[model samples]
Target chain A: MFEEADPDLLPEGLSDRLPPLAAEALRVTRAMNDVLAGHGFDPVQPPMVEFERSLASRMAGTKRNRMVRFVDPASLRTLALRSDMTVQVGRIAATSLKDAARPLRLSYAGQVLFLKGNGLEPERERLQVGAEIIGNDTVAAASESVSLAIEALKAAGARDISVDFTLPDLVDTLAASSLPLPEAAVPAVRRELDAKDAGSLVAAGGEAYLPLLYATGPFATAIEKLAALDAGDAVASRIEGLKEIAAHIDGAARLTLDPTERHGFEYQSWFGFTIYASGVRGALGRGGTYRITSEGGHDEVATGFSLYPDPLIARGAGSAKIERLFLPLGHDRDAALRLRTIGWQTVAALDASDDARALGCTHVLDGKEPRAL
Target chain B: MFEEADPDLLPEGLSDRLPPLAAEALRVTRAMNDVLAGHGFDPVQPPMVEFERSLASRMAGTKRNRMVRFVDPASLRTLALRSDMTVQVGRIAATSLKDAARPLRLSYAGQVLFLKGNGLEPERERLQVGAEIIGNDTVAAASESVSLAIEALKAAGARDISVDFTLPDLVDTLAASSLPLPEAAVPAVRRELDAKDAGSLVAAGGEAYLPLLYATGPFATAIEKLAALDAGDAVASRIEGLKEIAAHIDGAARLTLDPTERHGFEYQSWFGFTIYASGVRGALGRGGTYRITSEGGHDEVATGFSLYPDPLIARGAGSAKIERLFLPLGHDRDAALRLRTIGWQTVAALDASDDARALGCTHVLDGKEPRAL
Candidate 1:
């Protein structure tokens, strides 16, 4: 009977970050944010909830169904807990920071809530740390984003990093001109490409898109294969842009090409890349070129990346243990402050019977210095 | 036509933190969390949402109405966004960290969402930074909490800090013996005391509780007035506990006594405190002794404080300006990294037309050295 009434039960797909894991999460987030700041990305914080229309309209492909929603008591408008913070940064660029500068660099780190878990990933809440370069989607902006992403992941203690590039609008780019197809067949062709099913691509009237499937793995070879395909000049500039970005981050991180990989690149445009590390379970993060559509229907180009560092943190990356000093009852307070100033964690005794080792302290305060227990 | 579909509008009581203000919020949160960690408080992160029953039933006085709730599709159970993180800490102490040392110290910093804003405050979402001293609620525990809270607030750039102390169960302690009342009249007495209406307090059959109304002033004077009240020896030990806690933080902050003050001290017991700082619009934080009721119906004492530092962040405290160096096209990348290593924020130009001053850079990179703009 009491089991059913347990007050400690957390909801499914959620759990508390206890001890070292919690510290690791904070450290990894700070490290990544610091990397962004070092590159002149000023940090910005967007509230966790916003009007559903506001959240969905700032960026195309931001699905309203993914966000948890409720009616706002004040406005009677539907409010949504943010499923992605990228749109929020876009909103800020279009409104509050609209006049700040061109090619604005802003960073944000926050918890985003989703209405449901996707596929095998049962995490409804995740910590997203990212940087956005607004007002420009040039080849230079794309290159900067790719380089900064690789650097940020390395700063967070991720090892053997790899980046897999994609062109989110590749199908649209091809279908518009060189590889003409009926507008109705576009979605099916994109789906078949994502499924990597060549037979299904033909069934979807995308027989000419088969060459795109084999253009995967090693960036250098894959780019050559994609360039050799007879899609005319429709994707010529895009292929050259991808080559430039790959050259920029060549020595820093392992690079690959999959022009049709569209798993999490819902709002990405011409360029996109997914990051991975040797020991991590899934893709560490993704970034690419995109556009922020303003309230007046004007679209401003931009490039950025958002990193879901939970997997990296869960692997115990970047958490450093500190020395702790136990202060007995009646210990000198000034002496304890001195120790703390030099980086010692101090826990004072509440009473005479309190034990030092039991409180997780490795040393006892001996006058002003910490003496090993 | 665009006005109806504007996506830039945030819900009432919600706003974005842009530019310097956003950076300041991060700095303030880090300073307070650092103070917590220096005192040996291990960091923990509880998810933003939990089961409605789990959250509402963790600690006494946690109202379910304050939480924003919705159905969890996976569990088919009601899920509520956390309105307070203190009860979540209590649940962790009783469950996940049950076998840890006595007097466990845990710190947490996160965003909490409420269903509605309180009168005058008008903030439905807030950042709460706090530390808990679980497994103990002794006078020493209360003293540590008071001292830590003041220190944390000061570290976050608060000045002229003041703490108002109260006994949340004062009426219960009095009505049980000295000023006995019908069980039904107890809540009315509490309401009248909170309102500070002397006439209504008497009308509520709390005539003998009138002395507590006079016990509201500076700590030294008001504590004495409370001591002079002709109650049985019921409040004698509690008054002593308050005195000891005051003495511990005597020189650190201004102290006051209001034994019947019970506005937001819903779950507090023998001791409670509300912290205020000079220039801040309202209370910075509150803490006191409380008991955590486990699923087994066992009560374990705890003392803690949660600081809402948004007011201080809004005041632009703790944000430091850094000189940004703009790297023109074809500038040295290694030199820029070296400049960043020595604390210069570097923003590289995306193209030749990008202006340094427009991007908020105080200096531009001239070879390896920064030339003031």
Candidate 2:
């Protein structure tokens, strides 16, 4: 007889969220979603799978290879599991919501999958909670996006929140006028600047772009230094836009500036930002102004942020133990129901010899009232 | 120029849930999940994808072919998107919570995907919300599963809910003793009985099981008719169990009994039920006493129900328009914050020309209070 392999083994990069951890994750998701909704962001839910081209074409820099793809049995066409829902929201805005009012505020929270994990991050699946302000990407919209992202993180119990601003299109803004670079050398310059290596920055024929490396850190002084740079008209307006956005969310969170940071802001246009909090490892979420491709392939400006709050959830998971009331056999059902309505978690006994503490109950229902055991 | 295919074209059976409909789905899910939690069922979240062998081997009758499968690039192993979450819950109970406590109550709500649509229904992805009572499948456990499922549906705003009970293993129990059949002839007998064709049942060597076909309808009469059948000890015990379960939820929901209905009760053992509501097109949910396969391949008795409330959600979708408050440019930010805290969905204007009614606002924030449009 052949021995069967272990049935409890989970796939690599995937695991079960058990007990209080699962409860905490739900709470965090609800908190973030509630914050989004309170600000009039209507919720939207897109199917987990879609045509590979649909997802890839909605936004620039959405890598098709990163999404888990398979041939759909119904369509006989390849379908990709969504690696990012921002693109799907863009699709919704451009199609189903094309006739809706301008600056359509749509929010979503769901599991997103990737074919491969990011470097040093073993997790391939994450909870992406986000809100998109479609049809506008003004400085006011940028300000609202940054402030809302901070508020959402605070609601989910993150403290000492920080917003690091970035200019996804800073190179384009500069190369067009102020700091000219050969057309072919643009990618190399962006790559070197993202790496923050001055030597590589000069080697890429971007010696003039070296000033951007210094024009970063603590938003107050950084923005002023960036403003002092003679980058002509386009760069000047963007600098002022960043200043206005920074002033709007100044006291809400610690502010920083990295005008040319482009790690996760692949499709963002003029402005981008990454959020962080003390005690939470890495970035809590990222947001910025960007564009959505319409059905006619025309670009519509939008601003939004997507928050991957797994770290926040993990940090808070299993820390809070719920007060459970054990209801003995023959206890009043109506009484138990009433208690449940009042927020008491009642675990009813099935038979005799059932122990309350063993079942993790903090209280036992004695007659009508819960008596701590 | 090469004309591109529509970027908004989603894969067949997949869709983007827009605005109010998406909000309704979230509300329905939360309402049901809250009911489960109030009943002391600790929430658990399992990943959308798992190893094919892990998912398939955890429970009997979970079809591997029905799940959407893809090769995991990291492990070079086949990974399957879950078609049913019950098996995943069973695996969690048998492993992670294996030593915590007996009679563990767990609840979950998430998306489940299928490779193929069911019969005439074109949906391949559905929101599956459910709760499981692990380590016990007693009459009381079965009773709780039935009543809790009803309560959840009611909480989600379903009206005139009904529960149709079935015994998944009815034929096997009877074929062993009271109405004996050749071991090889059992499948045909069960199939014929399920089809409700008396002539075919007799031709299929299930003539002795003829009365079982008539033993279905309203729980009161059907159960009495079933009880009158002389099927001896095993059948007698099951009949008593059914009676006890019915008595527990007597007035809560309209009850019916179909002792051999096996459509959606594939892995259920002694008892199974399908729940429905008036105005909803099909069954809202189903549950039963069943067995989960332990890592050592030993069967552990468990009872649970999974509610696919898509039809219910669709019926309620777009029926509720939220009351939104619009704040004009330069409106008091603190006043708007206070209003939002009290559940007013406030959408702030980006410019002076922004119209309140055009943005779906039912009222405009005049000073501190909302003035109806």
lDDT of 2 by residue, B1-373 (tens): 2125565777767777777778889899889989998888999999989988777876677888888899888877889999888889998887778776878899999999988787777888999999999889999899999999999998788999999999899899999988899999999998988889999999999888888888899999999889888899989999999999999996999999999899988888999999999987878889999888775655688999999988877778888778999998879888999998998999989877777888899999899889999
Query: Residue B125 deviation, candidate 1, in Å?
Result: 0.8
Alpha-carbon runs more than 4 Å astray in model 2:
A1-3, B1-3
TM-score of each: 0.96, 0.97
DockQ score, prediction 1 = 0.71
lDDT of 2 at A40: 91
| Candidate number of the best DockQ | 2
lDDT of 1 at B82: 91
**Candidate 2: chain B TM-score against the reference chain B:** 0.97
Candidate 1 chain B lDDT trough over 10 residues, lowest sum: B1-10
- Superposed by TM-score, candidate 1 places the C-alpha of residue B12 at a distance from the truth, in angstroms, of 1.0
Tens digits of per-residue lDDT, candidate 1, A74-104, equal 7877889998899899988888888788989
In model 1 chain A, which range of ten residues has the least summed lDDT?
A1-10
lDDT of each: 0.88, 0.88
